[model samples]
Target: MTPADPARRRLLLAGACLAAWPLAASAARAPQRVRDSRALMGTRLDVAAQGPDAEALQRAIDAAFARMTALSALMSHYAPASQVSAIGLAAGLQPVEVAPELMQVLHMARDVARRTDGAFDPTVGALGLWHFDAPQSSIPTASEIRRRISSVDWRHLVLDERRQTAYLTERGMRLDLGGIAKLSILQSGLDTLQAHGVGTALVNGGGDVVACSQRGDAPWRVGIRDPRAPQRLLATLEVRSGFVASSGDYERFFVQDGRRWHHVLDPRTGRPTEGVRGITLVADSLEAVNGLGTAGMVLGARAGRELLRRGEGVEALIASADGGLWMTDRLRARLVPVAG
Candidate 1:
């Protein structure tokens, strides 16, 4: 999907109860919040904040954009000279040390990869054949896929916490943080805002949203887009605190020969996942939810449900390719089911 599509937009909701400020009054005095959205990290970032704090908010937004740009440069497999690209060059041969931030993200990516059994792998960078952003991207051959698949190994990624470095054991191995870095950046932005004493803000980075504040009256309202009908709303979540993130194949895919090729590549087979079309997750932390959504999608309906059941403070909604929908009990509590 193109960036203009609403389905590609990530929405964050934050709500808080402030004893000093009433909800209606704060809503009235709501800082003059402005939004600036641009293509960053291969996705859109929507930032909004209120009060005379506009200047601080703008600074915070600029800081976030800058950080995300750096992250994209470090993690993008498309860039031939990026840190990730360097790792690819040394894959299966030597270990490449990475920056501290990159190392942290890589550690999280590796954990998700292991916990999800490679479903949410950062090593899918081996599948360099398909281009989701291209106008006419085509699928690669089975043999080509297999050859590259051999290089997709998350286990080869070695992290030294004491040294704060990341190493790729295989010669052609690469790291693609597309699954989690954006959320990390968003969380960083939120932390920045909070540090600046900006209690109210929303960071919506391409459908991975984190909202929080010790102020505000009612819960933050977040809209979930209907996967089958992008123009319509599926349900509205009232988030008093915490975050909500969603991943859907429909956001980035191409239709060729009646087959759909999405961006969420499976590390095991180096191909876009089938079965589940989309997955939405609600949790208190981005670190927890970052790779979980992709893992849930790759696990299909049953396994996805099982994963959610085992996770605490996490709720999920899954949409299948066959048009069937499933929701965890926690998610059901938050959503008002639409009549069939």
Candidate 2:
């Protein structure tokens, strides 16, 4: 055939476009990696995963978030109808049966309380009457604090493992798992992702996070946000696996008389813990250092160092209000400070 005409050339191009349409659509729909986030347990929970297809990744994300929702229902103090609230209502009166997961978290809370010498008491719930976010400014009276402090004893938390029951020996006592429960829930979400055959995933429960596998060939990188400047990062880490928990005094608090009255309460004083501004701990599991950060804020640098030394693979970076940083050598090695 001699040289084709312009009309013949246009018809040939149209045929080629129609033939490639299906393949272009297929490539567009192919899934590589995805991230999902939702607010649950009174905090933002996030999941990142890589999958062969979008549907599989969505299913895994749903499962992970569902696990968090269930745990929150069982443990959240904000939920008046929750099992935790029920236990509070029945305090000192009867032993309330609870789910195995709740029992496990409570046990872990007790362990932290003992290890911290009551510095990590979940019984600080007795001090919940104080509201930092109230429209009208108010502080708890010393007499009222003293009376509430009487019921703020972790020793009074009686658990019957045989019956899977929890009891508070004081009528007005309450349990607040605000410190440790988040980490436990994060671990549970990671476990759910694993069960769903997702090998590469990260479950971030607010400031606490856990990674299952590398981000592609490289390790997952996470930023530790600056406590003083919420928008800036103090440091970043290249984490291959395991947990990172960051606790800060600025997380929930109100300014009063030029002082930050935060939510990290000390059961002993029935008031917010002072001294340390923030603490970030890296460990193999939440079981290793779940509530240590909160207790570290109360104990200050000297005792915080001693407490961290007791753990085998735990590393920490603690910041004080004096603009000084106290960090374990191991954490220093892995942490990259953000350059100003």
1-340 per-residue lDDT for model 1 (tens digits): 3336452233433211101111323435544554567777766676655446678778876776676677778777778878878877876666677888778788889888888888788887778787877775778899999888987878888888887666777766667777787788777777766676666666776677777645544445677766656555687776656778888887778888888789888777778887887888889876668889888888887888888788777888888888888887768887754344
Which TM-score value belongs to model 1? 0.87
Instruction: Give stretches of model 2 more than 4 Å off.
Output: 1-31, 134-138, 214-216
Q: Against the true structure, what is each candidate's TM-score?
A: 0.87, 0.88
lDDT of each: 0.72, 0.77
lDDT of 2 by residue, 1-340 (tens): 1234231122101100100000111334343566787878655666777557768878988998898899888999778988888888999899899999999999999989998999999888888777866574468999999989999999999899999999998899998999988888888888998888777777776578787663343356677876656556677776767888888876667898898788888888988887788888888877887999889988887788789888778998888777778888888888777689
Give candidates' CA RMSD values in order. 6.2, 11.0
Q: How close is candidate 2 to the true structure, as a TM-score?
A: 0.88
Window of ten residues with lowest summed lDDT in model 2: 12-21
**Winning candidate number (lDDT):** 2
